[model samples]
Every structure is written in C-alpha cells, then in structure tokens.
Target: MDVKETAAYLNVSVSWLYKNAVQSGLVIYRFGTGVNSKIRFNFSEVEAWVKQQRVMGG
Candidate 1:
C-alpha cells in the first residue's frame, strides 16, 4: 500500500509512520533509490511487531 493507505490503516499520520514505524524498524521493507524504487510493508509483520511491543510494554 501507499504511504497514505498505510498511515490510515494504522491510524497515524504519514510523517509519524515514517519516523516511528519505518525509522524504528518496527516494520520491515525496502527503500527504493531508482526508477523501480518503492516502499512496501507487510501487514502481518507490522501487526506482530505491534503485539510484541504491547507485550513488552513499549
């Protein structure tokens, strides 16, 4: 999904998602640097990460 879609799905701002989720490695994906470059995220991975964070009281 696009950044907007991801942000809406997570109920967070786009900037917040980029800073917190992307920068913090809470979600895993690739950053493109060329014409074919794109951002991608796995919903399952994100969900699992969130659950782990909650369990760890983060």
Candidate 2:
C-alpha cells in the first residue's frame, strides 16, 4: 500500500502518517533513490499491526 491508501486504511491523514511514520506500527519502504524514490507498505504487515492493536473488553 502507498501513503494515501495506508492513511485511508488507518482513517488518518497523509500528513499524520508521515509524522508518525517512525512510531506507527506501519513500516515504510523506499525504492530507488533521490527524488525518484517511492515509499510503500506491506499490506499484510499493516493488517497484522491493526490486529495487534485490538483491545479486549467486557
């Protein structure tokens, strides 16, 4: 998934994703170099992360 898709999946803003990229469970991968580089996230990883965040309640 790309930045936009990830943001939508998380129900957050693109800017928020970039801001929390380091702390967020989502991992960002970069391809190429310089301005041509692109970022992407593993869909499965993101889903797993989401599952890990689930809370059990009574």
- Number of the top lDDT candidate: 2
What TM-score would every model get versus the actual structure? 0.62, 0.83
Query: How many clashes (backbone atoms < 3 Å, residues ≥3 apart in a chain or on different chains) does model 2 have?
Result: 0
Per-residue CA lDDT of model 2 for 3-45, tens digit only, reads 8999999898999988997697678899989988888989998
Candidate 1: list runs displaced more than 4 Å. 34-36, 55-58
Output the worst ten-in-a-row residue range by lDDT, candidate 2: 18-27
Candidate 1 residues 1-58, lDDT tens each? Answer: 6667777877889888867875656654667787676667787877776666665535
lDDT of 2 at 12: 88
lDDT of 1 at 26: 63
Q: After the best TM-score superposition of candidate 2, give how far the Cα of residue 30 lies from its true spot, in angstroms.
A: 0.8
Number of clashing pairs per prediction, in order: 0, 0
Give the CA lDDT, 0 to 100, for residue 41 in model 2: 89
TM-score: which candidate is best?
A: 2
Ten contiguous residues with the weakest lDDT in model 1: 49-58
